[model samples]
Target: MASGQWRALAEQFQLICPSGGAPGVGSPGALPGLASCGHWVNVAGLQGWVQALLDQGIPSFRCPRCPESPWLWQELCKLGLFTDEARARLEAQILVQEGATGSYRQCPRCQRLVQRLEPGPLRTPCLPCSQQARRLYCFCWGCGRDWPDTSPHADPRCPLQAALHDAPKIQAPPSSLHGCPSLRACPRCYALLSHTLQGYPSVICPECHCVFCYRCLGLSGGHRLPCQIADRQLVCGREAVTLLPMGAQ
Candidate 1:
């Protein structure tokens, strides 16, 4: 019989099974061992409608094993219907049932031995396999970024990552000097330099070469010239000491 004729026979048998329970057109039903088969078709049919809306045109689909029209199956699979295993099993069952010609037999798809009075178009490809076929990824440690690569499951370590891992680390410039009793500064620029200048153990202004008690200099805080100084000689608080002229003292 044609695939459509086969589906009608199966549907009639399911309705008459008493335990199989009656189902509406496109509705799902539970068979003894293949309880999910009916539900699968129902959902698959619904998904096909959604796909038709997405594709904007109904496309022809065919099952690998059965005579039933694969219109719904084709649309669902094209739109990512059931999972790989589910699709495969559903298709397999339909083929086996129809091919048996009413004799009882185990559905290779459902993997269950049962009596079949009819068969339908049942055959689908693996969705997971299809998805995996299109997958890809990569990691770049040097740039610290991960991205899609042409190869899926490629080597985790790349050339850039290796180089970055092997590169030597560098030290930062020192913020303060060690073993110096007090912090001093440059006499001309007032840049903080040595802690002791001209052998005096107190904060010294980097400019003007004046010395002040650590307290007046705000010892805990970085050394600073008095806020209101003007003249070079007496203008100050602590002054940063610089080498003096021969007679300047």
Candidate 2:
């Protein structure tokens, strides 16, 4: 949550990297350190776990044994668990997943990530591109198209409003998320995420680690139980319904 807390947590565990079977060493995986959750983990094992989570589109890095205690980015970096390049890539994915894609878009010319400095107009300028070209380079932040030399106040061709109103729909069947918008902004951190139907209707934001119900978009208390608002109205124009267990009908 905070830098100080992460630093304190990082101090609680000793991470040992493999030294190629040095003297008095047992095995590469034998260097186990007790994590903050009191579970033993090796550097290699933890790395594998983090990779698996990333592969699954789940960005939250928590103790394998305890999902409640999250491993902050700073803590992971301080522990040498991730390289600089890896950390940058992971943070980029987290930003996109956290619903920052709406605000942060790639420059149309150079394709470098850019965002509005003060949010004046939809025609946002890319400083890196401008510096490289020795001239102003702006783009339509709404549609990701090159900004025309016409009036900056109007772009009738931009389809951002239509795209936003017609967001993708979830196709997973038998789940509460079915028929709902595939993409959702986390209620806490506003991180955008698409449910893969690999788990329940509740999800944990990879950015803020906030658990929320994907159906009614309410805070789920760690998803310990079924969503209480499962039967409420949804944005997809269909009443939300929870599928009971196969034998519970």
Candidate 3:
């Protein structure tokens, strides 16, 4: 292709990848994983195009993939997108029995179709409201229902996972002296949050609701009281005793 033609082709192929994480086609600068398969075809060739992409673990996607056709699932299945492991799980659990209409696999308990099935038997967890809070264990990726995660599992998102990746590892700017006794600086936002009493259990960030333990100065909640963070975990932690009004105390 000519130099001008190459630029035009690049522009034409610069399709944005959805947040669903199909791969970023928004820019040519993106890495191979982020870039499209470079097949560059319309809906007619979507099936073949995606297959070629997934063969290399590169997700293929395009804009306006709506009016979901019935054949979409069948085509995806034919491509072996649903792995064998998933099928094995679905074997014993009946997904949707024959002659059942107006609903997908009825929840064994609630009989609701709000839950979506994916990759054969790798079905999502049950809805929390549909069942009780205590009985439910695993989370359903379909309805997005679950209890506050204590330990780690294949919950898609790490509940134990902190946005520590998003923000600075240790960012504790010293608070100006002579602030309210109830006030403490938020490491995440750098704003001051007010607690009811000195050395309170947790200081709830009014802006972000990001709970931080006043004692240990680590991200915490009512679930984990008295944060045992003896050693300073902040990235570049500095201890600055905040000044409080003497008359108030």
Candidate 4:
């Protein structure tokens, strides 16, 4: 990659952190040849790169090769050079590279071994523990703490607990599962009309009120926008459903 392209990608990924000074660091607006060194960065193997920089006395971003020791592994992570385990395998897509966490879970009971398999709620059976205890209960990786009698179950600390059950709730009007509590579709422009019913000849739509005909329920010049019912004479019980819902007489 050319130096400019490397800088561009670094900027895109926010990997380039500008510092005031280092022993041989590049100045702002003046980059060294490191950016375009054409070296492929293995986000997962940044430790190797950090080691190489330290051995070679290169000051790309920070003085990695300084006399004292610095943990460039953490710095590389802070620079966004490493793809997260969840997004590691993301394809060539510009946004997020797809990836998955290796299918494994820790045996909280033993605390010395790892379970190698896709973990599930009350599904991962610790063979040694089950055999030793002579019980059929399995372990759940949810909380990493709670164990169940018959099966695995999600615990309060489980990371997947929120994704499994957390659902967004939209609070609507007291009696209606509909649009805004204070506004309704405009009778003319199809704009939201205030529920308070403004203007004369029925509620005049705030937008293009001239076209509003609440009584006839028509549009501008009675063009009758398709948003509402056309040529309607009576509202039937629907209007009363919204208006006279057994509240104000």
lDDT, candidate 4, residue 41? 29
Ten contiguous residues with the weakest lDDT in model 1: 228-237
Per-model TM values vs. the true structure: 0.17, 0.34, 0.20, 0.22
Worst 10 residues of 3 by lDDT: 159-168
Residue pairs with clashing backbones, model 2:
98-191, 98-192, 99-191, 99-192
Instruction: Quote the positional error of residue 127 for candidate 2 in Å.
Output: 1.4
Q: Which residue pairs collide, candidate 3? A: 125-140, 170-235
Point out where model 3 deviates above 4 Å: 1-48, 51-75, 78-139, 142-204, 207-249
Full-model lDDT, candidate 1: 0.33
Q: Write the per-residue lDDT of candidate 4 for residues 117-174, one digit (tens) a residue.
A: 2234434566546666898535554334536475434343343322221111213434
The digit string of per-residue lDDT tens for model 3 on 24-96 reads 4423344323222232223323334434333433321222222121222222333323444543333213232
Best by TM-score: 2
**CA lDDT of every candidate:** 0.33, 0.52, 0.34, 0.34
Q: Which of the predicted structures, 2 or 4, would earn the higher lDDT when compared with the native?
A: 2
RMSD to native, candidate 3: 17.7
Model 1 Cα lDDT, one tens digit per residue, 48-128? 333332243212233312434243433444443356575555545443332222222233233222322223211212223
